[model samples]
Target: MKGLVYKGNNTVKLQEEPMPKVEAPTDAVIRMTKTTICGSDLHIQRGHVPTVPVGRILGHEGVGVIEEVGPSVKSFKKGDKVLITAISSCAACGYCRRGMNSHCHTGGWMLGNTLGGTQAEYVKVAHADSSLYALPAGVDEGALVMLSDIFPTGLECGVICSKVQPGSTVVIVGAGPVGLAALITSQLYSPSQIIVIDMDENRLSVARDLGAHHTINNASGVAEAAAAVLKLTDGIGCDSVIEAVGVPASFELCQKIIAPGGMLANVGVHGASASLHLEDLWHHNIGITMGLVDTVTVPMLLKLVAAKRLDPSKLITHRFKFADMEKAYATFGDAAKHKALKVLIEYD
Candidate 1:
């Protein structure tokens, strides 16, 4: 088998590797059919995620067929098509019972981090029953790839955590995939205004096509962006502010634009410390939330996709073959240059 291996000092290569087999009672080995690059993968390559050691396979989002299953695995078997979840969870754990599967004691986010991931021909999945979703018949596998991470992250962390409500004003401070995912799901609540901010005009245009009521290019600076948002909100801030860009400046913009008593949901994965302006926010009763995506909403999101209420496939801006994994990474890494969003990599 061949897999993309991360080398130290921000490098990766597609190299020959041994195939994975079911190693645990609850494990299953998946033969990947489709996969995609994520912003987090870029973070890992940039040495932002220190826990990811070199020589690790580098991907968490994929759709595949079951090649083998351990004796204890019951929900799926060989030949079943499944969506590999980014976060692996043992449903029996305390955190899992509390619906915080991202922190599941035994298996949280093991794939593509602490364990081998889905970028290869075969990848081992721990907590198989809780970590993989059975594919519905006739659904687009490439689109289902989005459910493996971004959609659930956007819905759970960005939309739900921020408490987007009907008729409320919402602002998402990034036009990246996750930010667009948040923009897509936030509409389920019928927010009166869905404003998306990003420095990239191409992404902002894409956001508009995907239902963002307004788009702001932050190239002029955060103050100008905040002033524009305030003008849109009639001098008030948004009822919910989602910080989808995992950077200090983006987070600061979220702080400046959140309405008093509103929620600020930080959906981006931050590799560095970001300051929280407590002195400035002391009078604003705002709630701030951030965490890894639990993916508990995969089932509901599947139903929504089946109903045609959501179309994550629209986020797919580029495609590649398994042989083009390195090229795919290059395209996704310089996303602004490529005008890319989600870059899907299909297996031969």
Candidate 2:
């Protein structure tokens, strides 16, 4: 089997490794059909995620076919196509019961650290009954992979966390894949205004096509960007502001631009410390929530996809074979090519 191994900062390579097998009665093995390089993967490679170990496989978004199952695995079987959740979770935990699977107390994260991930020929899926979602037949693997992370993360942050209501004004502070996902998910709520802020013109254009009512280049200035956002809101700030970029500046901008009593949802992975002005937030009575998206949201997202409500095909801008994993990461990580929205690494 072939797998991607992160050796050090800015270093990743494909290497031959032993195939994974079901280690426990509740575990199952999957042969990956499609996987992707996430922005968070870049962070792990660049030493942004200090918790991730070197030489570990680094992918959390993937879809594949079940090749083998353990004795206790009842929900899945051989030949079943499935979408891998970003993290495996034991559904019996307190956190899992509340739908916060990402922070599950009983442990569920595989890949990149605990075990080899889906960025390979095969992966061992623990807690199979709770961790894998059966992919509907005829679904595009490239598009369906987004359900593992980017799409659901965006949907949770942009729609659910922000509590976006029809006719509400929403602002998203980034035009990256997550931001674009947020833009697409925001449409489900029928927000009156969807403003996207980013430094990249290409991404902003993509945001425009995805359904953002307006796009602002934050390079111009946060106040200037906020002014454009305000213009769309008829001189008031947006009712919901999503900090999709995760930096202090972007978070600050969201805090500054949100209307009083509004919701602020921070979706970006904060690699470093980001400060918040308590005084500024104290006067407004705003609600602030920031963290990783719950993997438990997969079932709801799957239902939407099954109902033909969410289509992420347009977000997959590039694809590469399993042999080209390193190159695919480089293309997706490069700041020069703003054209790569979501890079899908196909296994063939």
TM-score of each: 0.98, 0.96
Q: Model 2 — TM-score against the truth?
A: 0.96
Model 2: runs farther than 4 Å from truth?
A: 335-338
Q: Which stretches of candidate 1 lie over 4 Å from their true place?
A: none
lDDT tens digits by residue: candidate 1, 67-185: 99999999999999999989999999889999999999998888889998888988999999999999888788888999999999999999999999999999999999999999999
User: Which lDDT values do the candidates have, in the order given?
Assistant: 0.92, 0.84
C-alpha lDDT (0 to 100) for residue 158 of candidate 1 = 96
Encode model 2's per-residue lDDT on 1-348: one tens digit a residue.
Answer: 889998896899899888888889989899999999888888888887777888788888899899999999999999999999887888889988988887778555666657788888998888889989999867677878998988888888666788888998899998888888888888988988888899998988888888887888889787888787777777779888988887888987887789888899999877578878897779887888877777766787787777888898889888898899988988988844748988888877
Best-matching candidate per lDDT: 1
Instruction: Quote the positional error of residue 90 for candidate 1 in Å.
Output: 0.6
Error in Å for residue 166 of model 2: 1.1
RMSD of 1: 0.9
Evaluated with TM-score, which candidate comes out highest? 1
